[model samples]
Target: MYGINSLIKSGSLEAAYPLHSGTYKWTVSGPLSDRQIYYKICLKITNYEMPRTEMEFDSSYIYKCYILDCINHFGSLMFFGFIMGRALDHPGVVISNPVSEAFYRNCAGLSCTFEMAVLQLTIWFVRSCFKMFTKLIIPYLNVKKRQKQHDSKFPNQKLRQWESDYLLNKSERYRIAHEYLDTVAEYGYVTFFISSFPLAPLCGFLTNIMHLRIDAYKSITLYRRPNAKKVPKLICFTKLLQATTYFGILTNAAMIAFNSDLVPKEIYRMYYNASLEGISHQQFSKIPTSTVYSFYKYKANEETCYYNQIRDDNQNKTLLYWWILAIRFAVLLGIEHIVFLVQGFVAYMIPDVPYSVQEQIAHQKKIQSDRRETEFSFNINRKKSVRETERFVLIK
Candidate 1:
């Protein structure tokens, strides 16, 4: 959603320095090493040092700067979440755990409870920002219609002078750019908090399971000398959980990245121009949402084509279309499922199994006690019968 200029202005390390082909050079200080240049940028954080080798020199200072920049960004964002988490009650969001008692009581803890609350507040803020940007500031941007310049050097077609100049002004352009970035940041934060809804229960379950496993292992080691060498099968279950979580995070990140990039430059231009010109709300509403979906679908189809590269000649086209549709459907279904889970349908369906398991075990114990009572009564009756028989025989 942001251009190179926007990122640089926003203090992103990745965009801090000018790119000369494949290499990045930084003459400035703060998270850099080796005055000398290197072949590849090795992103790291270290104190500045004079370059001893050409490789170290080639690595450049930009990489380390990028790392520090990202760390700072995340730190600031987390802090923002902490502060905002206290304000609202996100209906579907969950907070699973608090690292400290203070955090638990603070109302803005990073746990599911607090995070969800913050998410709701963030959403409200985003909506307000969007309204202010679109309804108020956007009209102001279109006010001064500067005559846009069309360079004669690459002119095959006529270009509007005002349109060209509007986009070139550093301040105007940055405003347009930053608005886009800010929207992304705000919405991303809200969605992130909302999505964390599942994390609390999952964490609690895993924590309890880990405690049980640890206790069981300790007991086995102290008392049962046998089967010490055999590893627990449940360890594999933990690994599976880790794998699924990692994969899901990766996929989600990719999707968000792709969607953000797919945003049309024309839309940005339209919003900026409309804001300045006082475009009618009715006309603005006519802007097509389908365009966004079309672009997304186009790129997604390209991926489907790549997957269909080795398919049979007869079914490739048909298969590709079907595959794309299936993928779209699957995505929709997954999203709906997530919504349902957030609304407590799925969570209610799988109400804490450990509690049920404990109840079942307790019930089994009661049944066993009743069986024992019945057996004891039967044995006492048999003993009396035997005594009576023996006494009768003595009399005879």
Candidate 2:
């Protein structure tokens, strides 16, 4: 859709930077080390860095400037999550020997809970920022017609030109890799700490609403206004999404298997334990809803005692739990690999450009080649005519 839209040269493509070859220079003030210079210049010729030969900065309005030298982008997000998890993870202080009934929600799962909460929050925050900022600014970008309107209506207004090479811009230095970095953080970094967090979707709802207005203000006064560049695709983002989806699947399975004690034992025992015994599943399923409560962990201590659940032949239980978790992980891992192969096969079979579009492009290229050839022949003929006339004059 975006490719077709951009093919029509629409202003909506402003969210994407042109994928072209161009000279991009560093205009940063600080003494850049040799390695830093190499990475910034040689490595990043064409990126969000330099969409054009020159990028103009807009300083008509003032915005907040922070000394981010002390701030580590990756560390900050990770630490924020860790701190939030720790701060909110108070499950009635830490108990040395916790007691949990098969009926009770085990609080020992706080670590997993904290880990999931942190990851979900981080993912949602990054998502909110990306979606909000990208949507708000693309409209007013180098669409000539819109720029003309802004000029006619507000001649005195000063607009921020595109800060493509924002790394050089000390004030907005973070903008350089903000989008990609955020996605990496959400999909890659936090997931490493723990598998899955269910609250991400819920958290995204609140952040999206708030970021809508925040980004609107930021676009008008804060960020640079670059001309609309056509985005062929978000290849990187799509990869991230795919990778995260696979991870989410495996992570959810792990979370459920591990956190069984955190939820109702009936859920775990009836469903998970059912797999261990064929008869129990049939028996449990045949029971009525109201009477099913009677069939639950009717044990004298298993219903009220966490230690009884944890310590009673706990070695066997621990081994079984781990074996189940490992089996689940392996199965999911295999499925991911299969899905990846299938996706690659499908992609290979499918061409990015449709046949009709490819034909149109080919026709346009042929027309251009014919026009150029005719112009070249005309030039040669004119030159020959001039030479012949000059020779004839010389002979006379």
> Among these predicted structures, which one has the highest TM-score?
2
Worst 10-residue lDDT window, candidate 1: 15-24
lDDT of 1 by residue, 160-237 (tens): 754453433233212322333333333333334333343434433443455455435433332222222333342222
Best by lDDT: 2
Tens digit of per-residue lDDT, candidate 2, span 169-279:
122443433434333434443343344455554454565467556655655554454545454654244555555565545545445544433332444455666333332
Residue pairs clashing in model 2 are 14-228, 99-306, 100-305, 100-306
Candidate 2 regions exceeding 4 Å error are 1-171, 183-199, 222-326, 345-360, 383-396
TM per model? 0.21, 0.40
Q: How far does residue 237 in candidate 1 sit from its true spot (Å)?
A: 33
